[model samples]
Target: MGNKPLALTALSVALGLIAGCAANSSTTSKAAPADSGEKAAATAKISPNKPKNDYNITVNYELGMHCTGFDFTYCCVLPPYNSVQSQVIKTATGPKKYPELLEADEEDHSVVVDDDAGKRFKLSYGFVDNTYSEGSKLAYWNVPYDVDGDGKYEKNENVANAYWTHLYVYEGLKGANPKGTSKDSEKLFVGLQIPVPLDNGPAGAAVPSPMKGGHLHYSGEKGTIVYTKSPVLDNVPIVLTNPGIWDALGLPLTPFDDSLVRTNPLTLTEDLVRPFQETFVSLVDADSGKPVIDSHSGKPITFVGTSPIDVPNCSRCHSNETANGKKYTLYKQERA
Candidate 1:
C-alpha cells in the first residue's frame, strides 16, 4: 500500500513520455514513398495533434497550516493558508528545459530566468468555487467571541458565541509580533474581518459573523501591496494602488490592476466533505500581456495542483463512544 503512490507516479511519467514521443514523431518529417497523395494524407492527420505553442508551465502548492483546531477556546486554532510557486519554460529555446543555463562559477544548481519576457510574465491563482464564505460550513464555524474580555462570551442577535476570540491576531507564539514596528510585519498577522452579518438564529435578526474575505497587505522592498480574496473571486488578481509593489514583486503593472493570466475556477472543496483545495496557474505573454494558451486544448496553458487541509474529526476520540464512555461535554457541545 505504501508503494502504490510511487508506482502510480512512475506509470504516469511513462505514459506522458510515450505521448510526447508520439506527438514529436508525427510532427517530424518522414521519408515517404513516391506516392505524393499518401504523404499528403499522413500530414493532414498529424497536423491536428501538433502543438501550437512550445511553452510549458509547472505549478506546485503547499499548505501553510495543515491542521487547524476548531475549538479555539480549548486550543490554538489557525486560519486557512497556502502558498503556491511556479516556473515557466519555453521549450523551443534550447535542449535545457529551464530558461537560463547554469553558470560555470555558480555553486548551486538553481536556475533563474532574468530575461525581459520572464520578468513581464505574471502568474495569478484563484479558487473556482470558493466555499469559505456564506452558507458554508467554515463560515458557520467562525463564530463570534468575547472580544471585550468579559467573563461572558459575546452574543450576536441572541445567538451565544461558540468559537473564536479576537477578530485579528498575530500568528507567532502567544500571538506576539516581534517585528510589529516593521512595515513588513503585516504578513505575519492573521485575522478574520466581518464585513457582512451572518444569520445566526431568528429571521431578520443578523449578527456580526466572521467575514472570510478581505484585503491582505504585505510589505515588500518598495512598499506595501494588497492581495484580496473574496467569496466571489478567491486569490485571483491582486489589487494595489502602488506600482512599486508590482515592480518589487516582479509582476507586471497593468491598468486593470490584475494579471491577465486567468485561471479556471478551482472547484476542489476545503471542508469536511473534501478537505482539500486546488489552484490553477497560467502564464502571461510578456508582449501581449495575455494568457498563454495551450495549442492542443485551445484554452489557457494551465497546471493544476491541490493543497491538503487536515480538518480534524474531533468526535473520533471525544464522542460518547470512547473506551470509558465518559462523554466530554465541551466536545459534545461543539457538535451540537
Candidate 2:
C-alpha cells in the first residue's frame, strides 16, 4: 500500500480539533522536553487503568508482536485460553453456562514481561479489535471513567474522548526505532493508538502506515509532550499467495530489535492523519521514525508493552449486555 496524504481540507479540520483538545486535556504523565527516555521508565512503574479520578487514563497500544497473534502470519487466530471467545465456548460446553451474551476480553490480551538482564517491560493494555462487537465496528476500548461518581458509567468515559487532540498523551519511546534500532535502547517510548472511529463503510479500511509529515504527541507518566520522529515505511513485499506462510526466499531474514542499524529521519507533512498511519495497530516511532517492527520476525511491529495499572472488570461492568439469552458476565470473579 502507498502512503497517501489526507485531503488538505480534511486535515485542516482534524488538526484544528486535535489542537483544541490537546490544549484543554490534562495527563498524569506529562512529557518532559529532552527527557522522554527517563520519563518512560518512570511511567512504566505506574499501573494501568489507574483510579479514574487520578485525572488520567493509561492503556497500552498493541503493535504487531514477533511471530505472534495478529501479526501478518497469525492474523485473526484467537487463542484457545483466556480469550473472550474461549470463555463463551467454555460457558456453552460447561454446566455453568451463561444463557446470554458474554462481555469477554478481546484476542491477544496484554501482559507484562521481564526480559533477561532485569529489564521489565509492562504491556497490560491493547486496542479493542472489531471482533468484540457484532457487525464490524472498529473501536478500541477506552480507559473507563465513572464520570458522575454514582458508580454507573457512560461509554464515552474511556480514552475515546482524547482522539485527535494535541493533549492526548501517548506513551512515548525515547529512542524509538520502528526498524528495530534506537539511540537509547534502555528508555524507549511508544505512542498511544487513539481510538478514533474510521468510517470506511462497506469495504474495510486499511490500517494506518506512517510516512513523511506525520507527527503525534507522546507523553510519559510525567506527561511531557514531544514531537514524534518520522516513521520508517515497510519496504518488503508481503507474499500472500500461500496465506499464513512466510516466503523464505522472497524476504530478508527477520532482524532482532537490537541488531538493526539506525536510518535517517524522513521529512514529514503537517497532515494530522499522518500519525494515524500504521502497519496493523502499531504507532509511528518518535526516534527511528519508523513503524515498530518485531525483533525476531522483522515484520512491522505494533507497539507491544504494558504498564502495571489495574483496570476494572470489563465483564462485570458490561454485565447488562446479554447474549444467547444469558448475562455476559462470564469472567471469573477473582480475575475480575
Candidate 3:
C-alpha cells in the first residue's frame, strides 16, 4: 500500500509537470508590463468623468492558454477576463476614450495590458482563479506606464499604476443567502478593492471594507482622483458555528467562538463582514491622473464578473461504471 501511494504521488507530479510544460509553450510568447511608473502621486484627488461616446477607442482582449494540475486543487488557471471592460480619459481639451489591450497567459503567469490609454503605459496583470469558490477571481494589476511612447512597457517608469481587485459572482452565495433573503442584497456580484502603490501613500494605511462604502482620494497639482467601491447597505448576519464559518460565504467567523461547543456568541456587522454587489476600480491616466473610460460603451471600462458559460466538466471524462461482471471506475473530484 505504501509503495502504491508513493507511485501515485510520483505519477501525480509527473502528470502535473507534463500538463504545466505543455501549457507553458502557449504562454512564453506574451509579455508582462514594466515597473517604473507604479508610484502614486503624493497629491491626487477623487474625480470621475462621464464616459464619452464616439471617442474612437476600443480594446481587444485575448486569452492565451490554461495549465492543469493532477488534482482539482493545484491547477494554475486564470478566470476568463471580464466579459466587459472599458476605460475613459479626460484631457484639457475634451474627454477621450483610452482603449485597453489585454494579452494574458495563465500557464506562464505572465500578463501585459494597457492601463488607461493606448501606449501610455502597460500594467502586469497577475492572476489565479479561486478554485475553492465558484466564480471568484482575484488578481493584481500594477506597473509603470509607457511614458516615452517607445512601445516598451516596463516598470521603471516614474509614474506607477497598481492595485488589487477581487471579483465574486452570485452563484457561490446561493446557499449563504438563498431566496435573496436580505432586503439590501443586490443579487448581482461583489468585489474587494485595494490600491497598492510602490513609492507613494502614507505608511500603514487603513484598509477599507468592501461591504462598507468608502473611497480613496489622492490629490496632486493636476486634480483629485477617486477610487470607489459600492456600499453594503443590506446587512446579513452570518452565523458562526462551532465547526467554524462554513464555506461559500467565507466570512471571518467571530474570533470569540473559541471552543468546539460554540459557547461564545457574536455577530459581526454587515459593513465589516459582507461584500457589496458592485464595486469600481481604475488606473488613472498618468498625465491627467483621472479614471479612463471606454469610448464605445461610454462607461468606465469594466470586466465581467461572471465566469464563462462553457467550462469543461471533468466528471464527463472521469466517470464510474459497472456492467454485469465488469467494473470501470476512475477517481473523482468536485468542480467549483
Candidate 4:
C-alpha cells in the first residue's frame, strides 16, 4: 500500500507546523554586525494580556505486533488488528508557559483542560472518517462466510456480528450481545474449513494455517465471552452484555462516548485500507457547547492530525530465496 509515503507526508506536515508555530510565537532578534564585537540586542518582549492557547494531538498504535502479511495460511496468520490510542495536550502562551493534560469527562460527555491562568475550557476528540456506526453493513472481507443457515452466504450487515467474528477468528476470544436473538444480537458464523498447505520455503515445511470453525461459549463471567470448541462449552445459555463486546473491540462502551468523541483505544483497520487516520481536536465552551474561536484566526481553535501505520514485512528479507533466486538461511553464522 501507499502507507509509507502517506506517513512521511504527514510527518513532514507536522514538522512544518511546529516550525511555523515556533517562529510566530518566539521573539525575533536582529542580526549582529560582523565589524563590531557587540551581540545583537534583544527586543522588548510583547506579552499578551491573556494567555493564548494552542493544542496538539498525538495518536499511536497500542501494539507493534500488527499482522501485515497477506498470506493467511502462515503460522503467524493474523488478520490486520490495528488499534490506536490518542492524547491531547493544551499549552498556554504567556509570561509563564503552562502545558496541561486534557481529561475526558464522562459526566458532561466532554474533555476538559485548564490553562496556566486557571481558565478552564472544554475540548473534543474524534476520527475524521472510516468509522462505522451501529448496524452498518461491514465489508465482505470482514465476514466472508455464511452466518445464517441460508444456502447463500449471509450478508454481514450488523457491526456487532462483525465484531464477534473478528474476536473469535483473530483474537481467539468469544463475544455475545446482551440483546436477545434479535437482528442486532446475532453473531457471524464461520463455516468449518480445512487448511491448504504451501511449500514456498526450503525443505517443504508445512506452513501455519488459519484457525476456523470456533464458536463463542460463555465462560461464566458476567461481561466476558470465551472461545470454545468442545461440545460441553457449546451453547451454554448466558446473558451477554452488548457493552462487553463493544469494549473488547476498542469501541466506546457508553452512548456518551461515541466515535465523535472517542478518547482512547480508537481502533482502525490495519490492512492499508485507511492506514492514515485523521484526528481532530477542538476547543469548546463548556456551557454553550460551541467551539471556542481564536482571536488571531477568527475561527475555532482546532488541531488536525494524522496517525499513520507502517507494518514491516518480515518475509521480504527473511525468506528462503530472494527475488533473484538466491538461497538464504534463517540464521547466518557470524564471523569473529
RMSD of each: 16.7, 28.4, 27.3, 16.7
lDDT at residue 310 of model 1 (Cα atoms): 52
Instruction: Give Cα distance to truth, residue 125, candidate 1, Å.
Output: 1.6
lDDT of 2 by residue, 1-336 (tens): 111222355543343342232233333554566755654422323222111110111222222222335456545422111110000000011122112111111221111111111221111112122112211211222346443346766644433332222212222212122454333332222112332222211101111211112122211122222233335632222211121110111000011111121221122212211111111123233335455443434565333223111112334333333322354445334342
How far residue 209's Cα lies from its native spot in candidate 1, in Å, is 21
Candidate 3: count the clashes: 39
For model 4, the superposed segments whose C-alpha errors exceed 4 Å read 1-53, 59-65, 68-84, 104-109, 115-122, 129-137, 140-274, 309-336
Off by over 4 Å in 2: 1-216, 220-290, 304-336
lDDT of 1 by residue, 1-336 (tens): 000121244543443342352354345544667766555333432432222344444444433344546666687654333333344444323222222211111121112232423333444444334323322233332445543455654444111222322222233112234455323335321122322234221100111112122111112222322233346642222322231111111111111101222332233222223444554555554446577666566888656666454545634434544523554355455545
Local distance difference test scores for all models = 0.33, 0.23, 0.26, 0.36
List candidate 1 stretches off by more than 4 Å. Answer: 1-53, 64-76, 95-119, 131-135, 140-272, 285-289, 295-298, 313-336
| Residue range 1-336, candidate 3, lDDT tens digits | 000111344543443342232232221232233564664334434343322332212222222123467787665644322211222212111222222123322221111223232433211111122111111121122324544346776543322222212222222211243455443233332222122222222110222211112122211122211222346534333211111110111111111111222221233222221111222333334344444565555565332221222234423323432112235332334334
Worst 10 residues of 2 by lDDT: 82-91
Candidate with the larger TM-score of 2 and 3 = 3
Distance from true location, Cα of 272 in model 3, Å? 9.4
Highest lDDT: give the candidate number. Answer: 4
Worst 10 residues of 3 by lDDT: 244-253
